[model samples]
Target: MRIRIGGEVHHGDAVDLRGVDADATAVRETLDLAADDPLATVSATPPALSVALAAAARERGHDHPNDAEIERLRAALATTEPPDSSDPAVDLATARRRAAEAGSDVARLRERVATLRGRLRERRGGDAEPGTSAGEAESLAEVESAFEAATRALTEAETERVAARQALSRATERARRARDASERERSRRDALANRRREARAALARELWDEFWTAFDAVAADAPATDHVGDDPTAFDGDPVAGHAAAVRLARRDDPVVVSAPLFDDEAAATVRDRLRAPVVLVSAP
Candidate 1:
């Protein structure tokens, strides 16, 4: 059977070891399962052991309930005939219920006893009682005062305990949410990094294509002989063509960074004046 233990899943034994003499192998196996589970307790109580075994079964992913399977396992665990008794182990549910009721009873009884003691103390003193003045320490009044003090102390302690539990619960929830948010942030960052990589790769491809196109145009329009004899200079206003010429000239260098041109509005006037070669106006970084 499946059960929820400490907010986690658990599975019960398949075999009805309830009335059987369980063997060492079954016990060892159950212990082994419990040992692997962080939440499972490894105490001496059979009820606790049963709970751990149940948790182990849940961990193993047993969803269907099978009484026949349980009986088979029970047979393997036993060396003799099963006992005809019902109380094989303690029921955790019943135990918790009883404990809650007992605590309530204790609280009620304490209040009742305090009330009774206060009443009894109030009845002790006569009209002209011994002690100080009328407003001062009377024995009955003192007893009632002490009882009130004790009750107040107990109430304060219980309140503190409740507040502490609530604070811890809130803190745990906040921590869990923070952890979840951190994971989401990490995933988002990784996705952004991948997108940036893709963009850079695409940019590189575009740059390569532009460079190749400029080279091809220059090679097709110019002569293949001596540089000065077959002039490649422009005399007219062809800003677009001049830009392409500058790009081609820049590409001729083995190290492109040293030869790459910087676009300047003043470069058009300079190019119109000196029409010998592609002029590059670049700033050193």
Candidate 2:
């Protein structure tokens, strides 16, 4: 049987204790002795070894239900309930499309404004050329009238382009707000789902019930060891120091296990103190 202690997996006799009847009294005595002198009391007996391994596994927070099982539970939970709100996905997509259309409109209007301005400039430049005689005064008057009309058109086009830009800005802001709201909703949903998964896993594992029973049985007659501090460093709170200490104890065949990422070679050497048992590191697939 394979046993996962913390994130580390131990196979063969290292963890296997199937059908081995555990004597609560003997296990407790061994634990008490191991607490004081780990090397002397932590022998290769099935019951004692199992208790040690279980305790270690608990310490490292590796006593959860299997990942595949938790994932299955989560999937079932998701299917059983309707989502809290209508999916923001479609809303977000619509907002983005509207923003894009508005931007395109702005671009088109700006192009029109540029064309009108260019025409006005060309007309004015032609009028500036000194090629008009008094006989063509009426022609010059007609040219001036056309130039004024071009100027008016240019002004109207510029005003429309400015309006288009403002509309685009509003649309862009709406899209941004929509995107932010969608993200926040997703994050909230994910956090809720994660909590549900953890609750389900805890129920399935029943580690708390088992650990409490074991603890009660052991504490009934055994004296508590002072090796662990009143507030022992928690794996989640101080991972580096906790993992280091756990690994050190586990190597000495103490009732402790650790699940953590592998440290660098130098750090590992410093922590392991040249021990031969390789530190096992497990990661999610």
After TM-score superposition, the amount by which residue 203's alpha carbon in candidate 1 deviates from its true location, in angstroms, is 3.9
Model 2: runs farther than 4 Å from truth? 1-135, 207-285
In model 1, pairs of residues that clash are: 11-54, 14-70, 15-70, 23-77
| Tens digits of per-residue lDDT for model 2, 120-200 | 565556666697666566655665666566566656666665665566566566667666765665665676667544543
TM-score of each: 0.30, 0.30
Model 2 C-alpha lDDT versus the unseen true structure: 0.41
Q: How much is the lDDT of residue 115 in candidate 2?
A: 64
lDDT of 2 at 243: 26
Q: What TM value does model 2 have?
A: 0.30
- Alpha carbon lDDT of each predicted model: 0.38, 0.41
* Best-performing candidate as measured by lDDT: 2
